[model samples]
Target: MARPGPRPARDHGRRSQPRPAPRPRGRRRRAPHVRERAVPALAHEGEVPSLARRRLSRLSRGVPARLRGPRLLRRALSRDDRRPCARPEAQARLRGRGEGSRLRGAEADEVGLVLGSTQDRHRGGLVSGIRLERTGALVTARFDKARGNAIDEPFTQELLQVAKELGADPGVRGVLLASAHPKLFSPGLDLVTLIEYDRAAMERFMRLFAQAVWALYALPKPVVAAINGHAVAGGCILALTADYRILRRGGVQVGLNEVKVGVPLPWSVALLLRASVPPTALTSVALLGRNFADDEAIAVGLADQLADADGFEDFGRARLEEFADKDTDSIAITKGYLRDAVLREMRARESEEMDAWLERWFSDGTRERIRQIVAGMGKGR
Candidate 1:
């Protein structure tokens, strides 16, 4: 027949397999569901991130009461506490705690040395060559420096800073200035140091020196100088700045020896001498540049009183107490009125006077005299 009709393509002895069904439009096939294993809980209870734990521990130790416990924890954990370590109070507290702990590393060693030595020395603050101690309304600043508490750039600056601080504090009623050295209040200006300065440097030094002197002279609170030892040259100038000068009874000498040293007295220093010294003795005291014994110092108005070493502190304290009952405002006002003319003159002539001082200080004759004096000191030592 017609080839048996294209006869159903011949059966090749194999059964036909059915095709897979098509996915529905707009619908994806779902993946098989997997059973996930649970993670185990931490071994300790109330566990937190390491950083958070550290923060909480610090807060618990030194933070204010209101900022401790859960309140602090909540704040620390919040996003708002991004810079928790940057808080000033927190930083200060942390520093205090660190100071209490053992010191390690270079920075810790440095800070520890300063804090420990200063605390031991004054139980207060140490600024350069000066050690300051505060007791009630009174502050005592003791000068202790190499070479007899010499008045150098650093010493002058520190003394000025302390004077300014005391003057600004309304609560500070009095200041006591004393020397740590037993035989010397101050050997005056450190000529060894001064001899090394150039003309410009000398000018700067004189200006700074004058400023320090004026700061102490004009301080509102009563200032008493306990001159327990020899105070010569610049030291004498310093003693005169105080409202009351109590010299310890001894062979210790006190006087302005600038003339002997081949240097002229600065105008400010001259004015101070005028105000403190007896008019009759001013010529001898200032012109001669002689060092006076405690008895003579008192007699000539170079020192207000004389006290034995054992009674030096008592004398100074007594002097300070003399003004204790006086009205602070009235006392300050009276002092201002008494010193206004001199202070005004000082302000007007500061630069010119300082220039003259520098000229004298850096002169060839003065330099040679200073060298000889230093050499003599070395030889004596």
Candidate 2:
């Protein structure tokens, strides 16, 4: 009996109570506001402004008054996702608010289909100067043989037709006046046509060439020039027509060296250079008729961008896609507005004024100097 009593006295008072049952693993305890935010679409699918206000109110509940404006503005404009995706054509067109040549041989076939026309084909030649690539929004100027890429009279006609078509099209988004020639964007104009023609035809050629340059300059969509090789004279003019120029690195010389070949830059082309290139560079270039290297061209505002020779396609594609992201209507309107100024300036300059300017600055005197320089450098062309 004594042993049993001793055992029963064993520390019942010191024993701890059994721990309460643990809460269920999946049952999370959340703040009330957090729970409301968890089902975002459900609470505010149709009430965007109201929901935004509610969220802002919640965010600013405890912040002092002075800090609220900055905080709210930061929240309003800040996008959770800034990465660009392939947007719908309409959406792609709205990104910005304000803001090629010929080739030798037969032309390439690079026309795209227009919407709803009996002829789904894009306008031939000039209108179809743009070629849409499969991988990106790359639209290169073609000089392939099939579609008459040759720089001849017939080809020029076709090119003009294409240009007219593009001008008329409301949906055309951008231009990339590229060339198929491996070494030359264009060898100036097709001398064959110009040399063979009489005075009347020569005048027509001049008018048409000027108009073509104007067309490129006037395109509402952003135009980027990608020169894989040399851009000489008329080709140089085409490059200048673009809002942005990217020259492939190395083995290329860009300038209006028409003086060397006994011609002057066209009036429209001269106006374009005046508008596009920096004043100093334009003077040195048009007046001197000097060849500018890639870096020099960029420095002079002749080339807005430059990249490695091998990466032209990738770079050009990205740029076009970026242009596509901008609002098309805004771009078109702004371009037209700016282009009207350029057109007026061009119209104001008389042919005599242009010729005199060229003669004073880059006449046969300069041409002979260039010839000596070229000979000294061992460049036969």
Best prediction by TM-score? 1
Clashes of each: 0, 22
TM-score of each: 0.67, 0.57
- How far out, in Å, is residue 234 in model 2? 0.2
Q: What shift in Å separates residue 25 of candidate 1 from its native position after superposition? A: 47
Superposed by TM-score, candidate 1 places the C-alpha of residue 374 at a distance from the truth, in angstroms, of: 1.2
- Write one digit per residue (lDDT tens) for candidate 2, span 146-198: 22232555445545555565556565666666765677766566553344455
Residue 127, model 1: lDDT of: 27
lDDT of model 1, residue 53: 45
lDDT to native, each model: 0.70, 0.56
TM-score, model 2 to reference = 0.57
Overall local distance difference test of candidate 2: 0.56
Q: State residue 22's C-alpha deviation in candidate 1, in Å.
A: 47
Best by lDDT: 1
